[model samples]
Target: MALASALAIGLLISAPGTSHGAGPRDVAGTRHAAGTHHLASEPGSPRTVSTGWSVPWGLSWLPDGSALLTERDAFKVYTLTRDGTKRQVGEVPNVVTTSGEGGLLSIAVSPSWNADHYVYVMHTAAEGNRIARMTFDGSALADYKVVVDGIRKNTYHNGGRIKFGPDGYLYATTGDARTPDLAQDRTSLNGKILRMTPEGKPAPGNPFHSLVYSYGHRNPQGITWDAQGRLWEGELGDQTYDELNLIEPGKNYGWPRCEGSCSTSGMTDPKRQWPVAEASPSAVAYADGAIYMAALRGERLWRIPVDGASAGTPKAYYAHTYGRLRTVESVPGTKSLWLTTTNADNSGEGEPGSDTVFQIDLT
Candidate 1:
C-alpha cells in the first residue's frame, strides 16, 4: 500500500518516504487498461496479492486468472491469494542460495497450466542455471523434471528467467556471469536469449540450430512479446547502460565490445538504453504500446513504448516509492500488468516482507 507521491517524491521514496497521508494508502492508483494496452482480464480497480514474501520475482496470469509469483530468496514458489495470503505450492531442487542475487528465480506456467498442469522454472541448479518443468496438482508439484541442464554458472549474473512464446516454443535469457568474453561466443549459453521447442531442442527455423535465438547480451532477466509477435528483452548492464533489445533470431547484441546503440558489423543495437544507476531492470512486460521494466538498483518501474522494433522515451513510475521492483509482467491475454516489489533483496530497502504483488487496472 503506497501513497501517491509527487513524481519527484516518488523517485525518492526509496528512503522510507515519510507518510504524507495515513499509513500506506489503499488506493489502486489509476486505471491502466485503456489507451492502446491489451487487456487480459477486466475485474476490478487493481489488487495486491501476497504480503510476506521477500524479493518476489517472476509473474504470469493463470488460465483461471489467478496470477503466479516467484520469490528468489524464499526457496519455494507459493500460490499467492489475490488479497495476499501465500500458500506454498512447491520447492525448487538444487537451489544454491547466497546473497546479492540467487535462489528460486523465475517460473512460467505451461501453455496449459489447467490441463497439462505443468509449470516451467529457471533456477540456479547444482551444475548451473537450468530450466525445469514441474506438474503442480493444485496444492503441490506431482513431478519435477530437468528439461535442460548444465549451463555455465557465474555468481553475479545467473540470468534466470523463462517464458513461452506465442509460437508454443520456450524462450530463455542467460547472463554473462560477469564474463565478457562468453557473451560473444556462440557456443556459450551465457548472455543470450535461447529459443527451444517444448521438448528442449533447438527450435526449427531458428537462425541457429542449437536454441541460440539471440546472443551477445550482458544479463537479460526479463523476456516478453508484442502483438506482432516480436520478442523483446530487458538487459542489465554492469556499470554502464541497461538495455531494451528487440531480440531477433541469431542476432548478436555486442556485449563487452559494445554497450548502447553501436553499429558494429553483424551486431544488434538496443532499442533503448538507461544508465545502470537509473534503471537496473530485471524483468519487462508489454502493454499500451509500451514495455514496463522492473528496476532493482534504480528503485523504479520504467515504461517505454515500442513501435515495431524501435522504442520511445521512458515513462517512470513508483520511483523510489516501491523501493525495488524486480519484475513487471503483462498478465497473459490481457492488459493488466503485475508489478511486484524487490525491496527485500540484500541491496534493497524496507523490511524483509515489505514486498507486494500489484495488478494494473486496465479498464
Candidate 2:
C-alpha cells in the first residue's frame, strides 16, 4: 500500500460570485445528506489492483465488469478484471502523440454493449483530434470509424474525455487547443462539451443546433453525471483557478473573459473553485452522493459532496500519496472507485511503467 503524505492541506472552497481570492471554508447554503461534506461510504485506504502501466489515461467497464483501459503514449488498450488480471485487448490505429498531452485518450463502452458491440474513443490525429468508434467484440477491437473530427490539437490542451450520459447520448470534452479564442466560438468544436448521437450526429435537443452542448471552456477534462442525471465537469484554469462546474446546456463558462468567478452576465460560474496548485483535475466520477476528482499536479483525490445544484466544502484525500492521478471511475454497483496514475507522462515525475491503479473501497 502506498503511504499517505504527512502534509494535509486545507483549502477553502471558492464561491460562485466571490472574487478570485479564496473564500470561506464552506459555501453558505450547501447541504449534505449526512449533515456534512463527508460521504456515508467514506474512502478507505487504497488497495493496489494492478501495476506495470505507462500513462493509463482512460477506463471503461465492459458489461461483464472487466474494464477496458487505455495507455496514452503507447496507443494500446487492455482489459483488466477486479481480480487484477490484465490482458492487451487491442491497439488504436493512426494515433499520433503531440509529444505532450495528445495521443490515444479517453474510451467509453457502449451503454447497450450486449446488443451493439461499439466502443468510442477520443484521440489526437494528424489533421486534428477525432472522436472515433471501433468494434470491440469481447477480446479484440476493430472497424475504426470517425464519429467527429476537426477539433484543434496543441501540445498541452487536448481535453480528451468521453462518456455516454444517462440520456443515452455521447458527451465529449475538448480543450481550447492553445487558442483561447476558440472557446467562445460555437462553430468550433474545440473548448466545448459536445453532445452527439452514437453515429456521431449532433444530439437532438442540443441548444446550439450543433454538436456543441455548452461552449466557452478552457481545458475541461473531466465530466460525469450525478445521481439525478445532472452533468458536472472539472476544468483546468490557466494560472489562477481550477473549476468544478454544474454543467447546463447552452450555458457559457467564461474562459478568456473570466477565469474563476466574475460578474460577467450570461456566463455561468463554477459551483466550486480551487487554486491551480491544488487541482489540475483530469477526471471525475460520481458515487455514493459525492464526486471523486482525480488530481494530476496535486497528486491527490478530492471528495465534494453534492446536493442538487449546491456543493459543500471540499475535502482532500490520499494527498500526495499517488504521484500524479489521471483518472477516477466509480465502480458500478459498488461504493468503490478505481483510480489511475499518470506519473509516466511528460509532466509527471515517475518513469515509464511506474503507474498503477488502486481500488479505494468506500467504507
Candidate 3:
C-alpha cells in the first residue's frame, strides 16, 4: 500500500484543522443570484455534543428521524433514537474485516427507502469489497443480498462511501486498495465512483456504460449533492495534501500520479487542498451553500464556501477538541448538522466513548 507517508516522502506540510472546496451561494445562505449568500468562516466556536459509540463511520437518518450508523470494527450497524439511545440492528453479512482497513464501512438509505425500507451498505464482504442491500424491519433484517461485488481489497485504502444521488441512482466511492495502477484502470472498480441502479446494475446513460461514474480517486469517504444537484466529494491525499472536489461524472481526478492540486494537463484538479499532517478528511455535508467537513486527524469541522464550480478559502473549528471526526450529515429541517466522531479508531488520538453526535447550528 502506498502510505500517506509515502506521498509525504519529499517536503510535506502538516497542520491541523484545514481542508480544501463547495456550491451556488455562500455560508450565510445568501444567494449568488440575489446576492444573499457570501463566504462563511468558522470564526465562532462550535457547540459540540457527544454521541456516545465505538468507531462510527457513516450515518443515515431514517424517515422517522432516527439514525443508523456503521462501525468499522464492530461490523454492526446500530440504530439510535433522537436522544442517542442505541440498539444493534444487525451484523454486516459475510465480513471478516481482519486488519488492513477492511470492515463494515458505510450505509445509505435506499432512495426509495420510504417505500421499500431498504438500506444499502458498502463493506468488505468475504467475497471482496462489495455493495449490498438489506431490509430493516425495525428490529432485524431478513433479506440481504449483494447488489454489486468485485472491488479490489487490501489492508488499507478500502474506500467505502455510499450514497443516493439526486438523480435517484446509487453512487459508491472506491479506494485504490494500494493498487495505484488500478486507479488508472477503468475496467477496475478501485479508485473510482460508481453509479448504479437499485439492483446494482450500471445506471443507464452512464459515460462508461459500466459501474464507473468517475475515476482516478485515491480513497474518498465523503460525497453529497448540492441543492442544485451537482455532486461534490471530499478526498484524502497522501503525503502532500487533502482535498475537496466538484465532481463531474466520468472525469478523472488524478490520484496516485497526483495528490493535492492537479497540474497534469488533462486530469482534473481539486477545488481546494490542505497540507496532509493536519487534515485527514472523512465525510462532508453541503448546506446553505457551504460545505461542512469532518476530519479524522485534523479533528475539526471545516467550512468551505462555494461560489459556483470553484471554492474559496476554508475555515476550521473545534480543532483538537472533538477528537477524530468520521462523518458529517446535514440534519433535515434544520440549519444544524449531525456530526459523528471516531475516537475508537485504532489510528486515533484519544480514548473511546459513544463517539458523540453533535447538533450544531450553522446559524
Best candidate according to TM-score: 2
**Cand. 1 TM to true fold:** 0.85
Q: Pick the candidate with the highest lDDT.
A: 2
lDDT of 2 at 207: 98
- Give candidate 2's whole-model lDDT: 0.84
Q: Which ten residues in a row have the lowest lDDT in candidate 3?
A: 5-14
Worst ten in a row by lDDT for model 2: 7-16
**Per-residue lDDT for 145-202 in model 2, tens only?**
9989999999988999999998999999999999999999999999999999999999
Regions of candidate 3 where Cα sits further than 4 Å from its true position? 1-37, 40-50, 351-354
**By descending lDDT, how would the candidates be arranged?**
2, 3, 1
* TM-score, predicted candidate 3 vs. hidden true structure: 0.86
Q: Per-residue lDDT for 1-363 in model 3, tens only? A: 111221111100113333322222122221223223365323222344434577878788787867788888888888876555788889887876847468888899876776898999999976679998999877876588999999978888888999888788999999999889888899999999999999999999788999999899998888987666778898888887788888997888998888866558768878777766557889888766677777887876777766667665566766777678888887666555677877777774545564666665543
The root-mean-square deviation over C-alpha atoms between each candidate and the true structure, in angstroms, is 7.9, 7.6, 8.9
Global lDDT scores for all candidate models = 0.71, 0.84, 0.75
